[model samples]
Target: MSDQPVHIIANFTVQDAAKYREYEKGFFPILKKHGGEFITFDDSSVTFEGTAPPQGRVVIFKFPTEDAATSWYNDPDYQSLSEHRRAGTTLNFLTMVHSLPPRN
Candidate 1:
């Protein structure tokens, strides 16, 4: 797999705070396990020029590599934890963006 860093952007509206909190409690551990870093999140995101701006909370996180990000998402524990998120929130998208390759 390529060593390029990968960023994940997620948009979702929390419908059940308790359930979402349950997912959050286990998120960092799983993320750290796969070398992922939480960047930032915005509850009130503004749209400048985009036609389809995210409707709810916007979160951004990064991983050292695409493989790491993929592994994090595919991990059994993470998948199990995500059930809470799926039940508690309306997910818009969980997109993966690849960083530019090294300028050799």
Candidate 2:
């Protein structure tokens, strides 16, 4: 994979608030363990042009490298934690975007 930074865009709608909250509470520590950084999240994000906007929540975060991003996702603890998210939310997508290479 490219060494470029990778950004994650996750969109979901909460179905069970308490279960989703459980996921959120444990997310940060695992993210940081793999060099991830939370950028921002929006409950009401505007989409000027798109096939369609996501459901309820739009989240953005980044990792220093694609490997880091993948590692975070593949981590067993993260996978376990995501069970609560799966039970709590209707996930639209969790997408990865690569940053442009440094200008020569």
Candidate 3:
């Protein structure tokens, strides 16, 4: 397996839990298209370090390739579904590599 890692961090608000479910449903196909993995994650981000009450959900995913992730995001199908994610929540995101220490 490649040592490179694609880490995705998303902090966005969902108008309602039901809406979130809908968004998640629509989100699955796109993610699957890129052969991404649904790693362990949580939504109970009640507070932030030295910040006010958080107002959104937290999501993390590992993509095998940056191109794959980008393609999945820019895909015409996902382009529109992405709007729902934005509409339902305040999106805060960060995408980067792990850059772990060189394996001995």
Which candidate number has the best lDDT? 2
- After superposition of all CA atoms, the RMSD between model 2 and the true structure is 0.8
In model 3, the runs with Cα more than 4 Å from the true position are: 1-3, 46-55, 98-104
lDDT of 3 by residue, 1-104 (tens): 34465766776666766655767888877888887776655667655457744655677787776777777778998887776666667666645555464679
TM-score of 2: 0.97
Candidate 1 per-residue C-alpha lDDT over 1-104 given as tens digits, one digit per residue, 9 for 90 to 100: 77999999999999999999999999999999999999999999888775766578999999999999999999999999999999999999999999999898
- Over the stretch 1-104, how does candidate 2's per-residue lDDT look in tens digits? 99999999999999999999999999999999999999999998887786766659999999999999999999999999999999999999999999999999
lDDT of 3 at 85: 66
Worst 10 residues of 3 by lDDT: 93-102
Worst 10 residues of 1 by lDDT: 46-55
Q: What is the lDDT of residue 11 in candidate 1?
A: 95
- In model 2, the runs with Cα more than 4 Å from the true position are none
Instruction: Arrange candidates, best lDDT first.
Output: 2, 1, 3
